[model samples]
Target: MDEKQIIEAVKEAKEKSKKRGFNQSLEIGINLKDVKLEGADKINTSIKLPNGRGRDIEVGVFAEGDLNMKAKKYSKHVLNKEEIEEYAKDRRKMKKFAGECYGLIAQPDLMSIIGKKWGIILGPRNKMPQIMPPNKDVKEYIKDLKNTVRVKSKKNPTIHVPVGTEDMEDQKLAENIQAVYTGIERTIPVEKIANIYCKTTMGPAVKIKW
Candidate 1:
């Protein structure tokens, strides 16, 4: 798709949307053709928008020892080993916690327990915690995740993702949409994309013509 077309569609989408009390997130829906949501064909990955998500993204971290203390500075919810098991037993609490957190991170040591206990809940939602890389600062991963958005296709060929908020510049939102499009294109051919539409949280959709 042409970059100019994306920016134009974004501008039109915002113009059509009603102003809301809170900042509305800008979203794009990419409808694909002949793509199967199975095995390697499935779409499940993260893309870091060049322009960060306009709103604050709260990440829930699962860590212990020094990492746990370090995570405290970046995330509000840092679960230790015991706390990990605690939240696992209560389905209600785990669900609420998952809903509140935009992303999740975990220490490598806790993967086993987390997978055994919480995988069922977090797996399908794509909220499973990203394991922290060894010898790396937890802040780097958490910060990047805050600006990233997950694009997944479930039970449909259409992939929906939030590119940015309405408050962001049109050019920035367009670049984000392009980033997501490029990411999907890496898996599915561009010719396989049926249509691409851009819209705000409560706005009417505007189709992008290239």
Candidate 2:
């Protein structure tokens, strides 16, 4: 789908979103084409958001470079493998972080080895590995990557996100939301379900004409 199609769909989705009971919604722009799956048969996962999710995200970064150094200066969750696991060891906090953190990022090597343990808790919640280039600037990337609006379904088979705001001059929110939606779309299979919708957090549905 092109930009117009995504925008219109998000407009249409706003009303449906209201019936579900949300004060506001955000977009999670992910590259749908980039998501690769391990299994072909089953797709069992939950999209768990943070409590009072209406607030903007702090965006935690986990990298092996200066990003780690920067991340540590900001928050305790910003740490190496051993530290993260230790922090996650606290049953309640682990359950909360594992439940609500938007995404878990790492250098590719670390991801390949330790993704399994983290995946055990985060995978089912649509928070999976977004393995990044090892030397990428961790803090800066986290700012853009994490401050997204979510366009997800309510524990159903299909989800929607606000691709663009009807009132905004630019479509940054729309694009970001679609990217995240696209990533999630790739995570599932075409055979399972067909499409994802985008709409406003408070607006009604507008059909995206092809």
Candidate 3:
């Protein structure tokens, strides 16, 4: 879709979406056609929204020693090897942790340990910690993850992801939607994109013409 069409769709969606007690999120849904989801090469990667989702993203970091101490300054939650095991034992805590954080980053050496303990809990939810290279800067990783939105097509031909919130400018929201669409197009064939829809958390989906 062109920029003008996306902006118009955003305006329509916002106008139709009445103001509720709480701020609603702006969502983008894309339905695909003639796409095979049988293999492992599924669309399951994160895309950084150009204008963000109009909110702060909580990030969890898994590290140890110096890296753990350094990560604590930038991450909302930082867990070491022992702390990870402790959290794994508490189902309630683990569940809350999984739901609360937007994404996670872990030291490369501790990935196996995290997988063995929290994999069952986080794997299905797509909250698995992104492996941070040993030599890379943790702060940079956290900053990038904060701006990212996950896009996954596990068993369905449709893709649904949040582009922005109701309070953001229509143009920014449109740009974010375009960024997501562009990212998906790079991975999946553009011809397979059957339909595109934009909506609010409590609003009706408005179709956008490509």
TM-score winner among the candidates? 1
Which residue runs does candidate 1 get wrong by more than 4 Å?
A: none
lDDT of 2 by residue, 62-90 (tens): 55666678777644456566666675566
Model 3 stretches astray by more than 4 angstroms: none
Candidate 3 has its poorest 10 consecutive residues by lDDT at 37-46
Q: Which ranges in model 2 have alpha carbons more than 4 Å from their true place?
A: 1-23, 26-55, 63-65, 72-76, 108-113, 147-157, 164-167, 170-198
Query: How many clashes in each candidate?
Result: 0, 21, 0
Q: Between the candidate structures 1 and 3, which one is better when assessed by TM-score?
A: 1
lDDT of 1 by residue, 19-83 (tens): 99989999999898887788557887788888888888899999999999999998888899999
Give the TM-score (vs. native) of candidate 3: 0.91
> Model 3 misses residue 25 by how many Å?
0.7
lDDT of 3 by residue, 61-178 (tens): 9899999999989876888999999998988888898888889989888999889989989988878888898778888888888889989896888889999899999999999999
- The TM-score values for the models, in the order shown, are 0.93, 0.53, 0.91
- Indicate the worst ten consecutive residues by lDDT in candidate 1: 35-44
